[model samples]
Target: MSRARSDPDRKLRKAKGRTASSARWLERQLNDPYVKQAKADGYRSRAAYKLIELDERFGVLKRASRVVDLGIAPGGWSQVVRKLRPKAAIVGIDLLETEPIEGVTIFQMDFMADEAPAALSQALDGDPDLVLSDMAANTVGHKQTDHLRTMGLVEAAAWFAIETLAPGGAFVAKVLAGGTDADLLGLLKKHFRAVKHAKPPASRKGSSEWYVVAQDFKGRE
Candidate 1:
């Protein structure tokens, strides 16, 4: 068994200049099994496991040849894609700078920018077989406002997938606890053959995060 699989729980001592919240977060990271596993497995972030689990359950990566990864900072999801689909052509965009990955084209630009869509489409050079989005708007602490903000990004990602995905393509994106809202859900159902909501095991139990997987794009009719 891997060391990560056998490691015992750990705690961190409080440090100077650390806020209570920061200290708690550090302690949680210290004890998170997924964090240990990510270090052991050479993944940049624990989030890679989330994509792994989702793909295992949904088979999202099986047929993917060209992939678009939105909000690809730290490049964990892209790393997962490259590992699972070594021959896939991947293009990713994010507001934050991301370290280069072996098989991915990274663009450090805001996905909300007008030129972003054209840039990604051009880079892929073909309609993507899979579009993955792990975007969330920065929170302002108000629950309702935060939900709406993140949903806006999710909506944008869904529309991008619908517009640029090949027939039978798949879209997977992160959504909050309530899942996709009514209007967005309706849009996904209209464009895809199947739509489902999932909370992967890698996500924290206290987290509001969930995933919306839409598969079998019906073509632009």
Candidate 2:
């Protein structure tokens, strides 16, 4: 096992103070137990624990289920899905390239474009059991603009989920915390039996991002 797997907290503390910004980030990592545990568990990113926590709370993943992962660069979320359901077919798509991961098919494409969802559906070969979007727009230093941009991606992902989700499928996407998501939540409530928002432990404490999980697709459209 790697040293990070054995002494994650020590590694985080040692990583502190290399640079002004890095010092603060390291302090946060050291204080976050999830980050330490993720290092010890050999996961690629701390984001993996968010998926694990969400699944534990929602009972989302299942053996042999088909799962779609959006914005899956760096492969952490995909790694979690693969570990949880070894028999499941997993497909991941992102604008940036991702290194090959065992048992995952990755497509480098901008999913916000019109043609992306069709390409993703073609790759899946059938409807997916679960669709997960951990996508966020690159921060432009304007809070309102950033929120709108992120919401656009979330809405697009939700629309694609409506198109390709299996009858009883589930969709989960990241959203900003403020009241900006009310309209989108209303739309989701119409199509899903239950919809709830969650802030997983692995996420940064100061981040505006939260996840909206919509379960039991009703196929309204």
Candidate 3:
């Protein structure tokens, strides 16, 4: 049975200042097929495939005209959207400046800032048909704390999506392994016709991350 997967374990030579954990991570990245494929495909990061897979399954990007990309740093998700829907009017926000991508309006500031949602909406100049947030709080190693913090970001993104999406729009965001908390799930269920969770194949099996897709926005009534 083990012969079904033939790639041998790859180890790295011990190097100064590289911790064992860091070495393992580096080694894994070096050997990962998706990492290599990302480079070959000219993708900024492997996370691009996660969105692609999700869209393939859920039809999220099919007719999106106006889109908002939250936490779009290296711009992988935005890149995918740009490719699949070339005419999409994309506006992305990040605390870190992203290099220019054609036809995308980028805001280099914290999405948690008081002015963020309006800025994104204003830039789009229309309700978004797709709102995407790959935002996750920085981990501090405390499992409960990390989950709570990330959930806070997801909740905020959800509210932003609800407020800014056009009728029949969709919202997709990254959430932790156990999925959206009860209250957040309730909120999504009320606002969208379909609320589903998925862990795309590109997501590391060991990672505690998944995506919550809320589709068919019920309008602002």
lDDT of 1 at 108: 95
List the candidates ranked by lDDT, beginning with the highest: 1, 3, 2
Q: Please report, as a residue range, the 10-residue window in candidate 1 with the lowest summed lDDT.
A: 1-10
- TM-scores of the models, in the order given: 0.96, 0.87, 0.95
Off by over 4 Å in 2: 1-19
Put down candidate 1 lDDT per residue, 1-221, tens digits, no spaces.
Answer: 13355334556776899999999887888878888889888999999999999999999999999999999999999999999999999999999989999989999999999999999999999999999999999999999999999999999999999999999999999999989999999999999999999999999999999999999999998
lDDT values for all models: 0.94, 0.83, 0.92
Query: Per-residue CA lDDT of candidate 2, range 48-99, in tens?
Result: 8888888888887753388999999989999988888988888999988899
TM-score, cand. 2 vs. native? 0.87
Q: After superposition, how far is residue 114 of candidate 2 from its true place, in Å?
A: 2.7
> Which candidate achieves the best TM-score against the true structure?
1
Q: In candidate 1, which residue ranges exceed 4 Å CA deviation?
A: 1-9
Better of 2 and 3 by lDDT: 3
Model 2 — which ten-residue stretch has the worst lDDT? Answer: 1-10
As for model 3, its CA RMSD to the true structure in angstroms is 3.0
**Using alpha carbons, what is the TM-score of model 1?**
0.96
Residue-pair clashes, model 2 = 0
Candidate 3 on 1-221: residue-level lDDT in tens?
01122144766788999998999888888777777778777779889999999999999999899999999989999999999999999999998889998899999999999999999999998999999999989989999999999999999999999888899999999999889999999999999999999999889999989999999999998
Candidate 1's displacement at residue 64, Å, is: 0.4
